[model samples]
Target: MELNILAVGDVVSPAGVKYLRTMLRKLKQQYCVDFCVVNGENAAMVGLTPSHADEILDAGADVITLGNHTWNCRDIVPMMEDCPYLLRPANFPPQQPGRGWGIFETKAGPVAVVNLIGRCDMAFGPDNPFLLMEKLLPQLDTKLILVDFHAEATSEKLAMGYHLDGRVSAVWGTHTHVPTADCQILPQGTGYITDLGMTGPARSILGVLPEQSVAGFRGELTSRFKAAPGPCKLEGAVFTIDTATGRCVHAEGVRIHEN
Candidate 1:
């Protein structure tokens, strides 16, 4: 038996969340996805709120993963501890609210979803994801494990894919907000991709207004980053895993843009 898992990229602002609300169900149906995981740390352009989390959950995500911006929104602080479907990076301090991994029941059996953050260009201090993964793997009882490695550096993401190649069903990168073309099944059977991209304005810079991003880079202290307007797009990837063996047999990146 095969199970199709859809891993959506980080959502940027309300625009991204709106796109998910409108298209995620149809997209899941189009791919025959059995389980869905969405990276939603950017639902508010900084961090998502409880309302944003609820909308994503209603948008058909079985599990919602977060990254460095996980604690940016004060409104979501309590929800992080109360919502089992919401996950922060596993490598975050143990005292932090919420969990980094969870096991959910699915028709294919129990599926485990792990959220991890990287230490690349990100200045935030968190435990080393690689070492944390190795320590956490033995604790997960299920073979159908899916991981969302929210990292900025492509090399780091690729290294993580290779690191857990045969151990997990699929490992995909998030936070880059640019879909990668390197979707493939690793030699050891894990489905891998450098990044799944972002679900928000397609023409913006990582879902923020391009002009604003340019200004900030130009040494101008631009106002707080805001979501770009106009057409929205949803980007993600689909991994077809063989349930019996807990290995990915096929992997493909997907995108949906509003006209």
Candidate 2:
């Protein structure tokens, strides 16, 4: 008893969306993935008129998780609330706009997915996610659990992963555009990755204009950040989990270039 889960990093722009929409289904088929998830915080980064969060879902994503940039356009919050598949952040605050975690009915069973954020170097409220999960998780009745820990610091993300190991099926980190080298199944049968990376103009500086990023660092001036218009790349991973044992049999990272 198992399921194929493909978790993507951030989708940064229209090009990123187009590319992911074009390739994800094929990728899922090739990998025999059961469910697909993506971080859509940057889908409207380059532009906002064509907020294609739905388009990405139409393509194949079962769930789309967001981060602090989730509120970048201001229009997405309400829309996210209307849809359970699109999450802002669970650990945001009890009264926040969108839900932090949910369960989707699948052929395998109901898969519970939790969306959490880290406190270090991020806009997080006083609510402690570690405590919140401990309190709220038992109420859910799914053993095949997965989490997208969106955070800025690697240490905090790893800490949370370790804390939740053996309890959850997988814990994959996001928010950071760069994917880390660490992707492994925990001793307790939990799949872990420091970061899934972003699917965007990969050559740029973390999805932003390299020139602007460099100028801001070099000069004492505050520069308006923007996304770079160029070739894009998709970064994510497939967590092949053995449900009976709750261990990952296969852990592979993928990168698709818009060439």
Candidate 3:
């Protein structure tokens, strides 16, 4: 009784959407993926219209997770209420734009997928994930729980993973966009990864052209970041978890590059 959960990295623009379809279209059968999740905080950087979010949903993602940039596109706020599948950081103030969790019906049963933000250098939200998760875990009727820990600090992500290891089925980190070397099943049975690599132009720096990001770093001039175009790369992981044991049966990193 194992279920495949494909978690994709940050999807930034139209090109990114195409990459997702191209790379993940074969995954349903190839990976036996029963559920697919993606982070879409960067969707509108190339200027996300509401159409951008819809495109991701229509492309193949079952649940679209987001981060601090969730509110970047103001128009997408209304989409949140209608599309509960789209989730922003749960720790965001209660007045935030999107939901924190979604109930997914899988072959095993219903699974709870939570989108959480770390309170380090990132957004200073009112709710605490450590405290909030303890309360939220009990309320969920399903044992198969997955969390997307989007944070800037490595300490935050790693600490959270240790904290929730036995409680959830898997804890996948995002936001940095660089895949970490650490990936394993925790003592408590939860599958864990420090960060799932991003899906975008791999040659670029975390989805943006290196030159552009470097310019900003140098503080020479402010430049609007754009998704690096051309051949793409998809980065993330697929975790198969047992419903009865609430443990990961298998966990593997997925990296596909399109030339």
Candidate 4:
């Protein structure tokens, strides 16, 4: 049987959550998605809040993954323990509040979702994701595994894809907020993408107002960053996996703009 999984990129701002509320279900229905995972670290102004997580879950996301900004909202630390479906980077110190991976029941059977953060150029400087995966994979009971690799460098994301090629069903990159055109099935049957882009304002700079982003880049004093107003766009990928073999048969990038 073929299982369709929809992996959404970082959700930024309240506008991003609004977009999901309006379109996520339609997207799932349109694609006949069997499972859905969303990177929601940016669901709030900087990091996700408990309410934002609830909003995404109510909007139809089956699993919510986070990255470096996982602790941006201090309140979410405790909420993580209560919400098993929400995952923080697995490489975080073992004492962290939330889990890095979990097996969830889906129409296609049990599917394992692992969340990891890249060490290169990251603020958290978590452990090596490649080595962490090597340790985690041996313990998972299901072959239908999906990984959300949140990193800044394209090289790191690509390296990870190759590192876990045949071992997981798919490895989708997040955090860059800009989508790449390299979605394809790896030589070993893993569906890979450099980045899934982001679900938020299409005109802004990584979901922040263009002027705000430019000010930061130009070394000019600027106020706190805020989500840009106006139309929002959703970016992600859909992977078609063969459940019997736990291999990706097809992968396609998804881009939707609010009409």
Cα lDDT tens digits, model 2, 1-259, are 7799999998887878888888889889998989988888778873222258888899899998877776668767677668888876787767767788889987788888888877888644636778888987797787888899888899988898899888888899988889899888877778889999998887799888888888888975755778788888889999987877656777778877887
Distance from true location, Cα of 43 in model 2, Å = 1.2
lDDT of each: 0.95, 0.82, 0.83, 0.95
Stretches of model 2 off by over 4 angstroms after superposition: 46-50, 124-126, 220-223
- Model 1: residue 140 alpha-carbon error in angstroms: 0.8
- Model 4 Cα lDDT, one tens digit per residue, 202-233: 88999999999999999999999989998999
Each candidate structure's TM-score, on Cα atoms with residue i matched to residue i, is 0.99, 0.94, 0.95, 0.99
**Residue 144 lDDT in candidate 1:** 98
Q: Is candidate 1 or candidate 3 better by TM-score?
A: 1
lDDT of 3: 0.83
Report the poorest 10 consecutive residues by lDDT, candidate 3.
Answer: 41-50
Q: Which structure is stronger by TM-score: 2 or 3?
A: 3
Native-referenced Cα lDDT, model 1: 0.95
The alpha-carbon root-mean-square deviation between model 1 and the true structure, to one decimal in Å, is 0.7
lDDT of 4: 0.95
Score residue 172 of candidate 3 by CA lDDT. 93
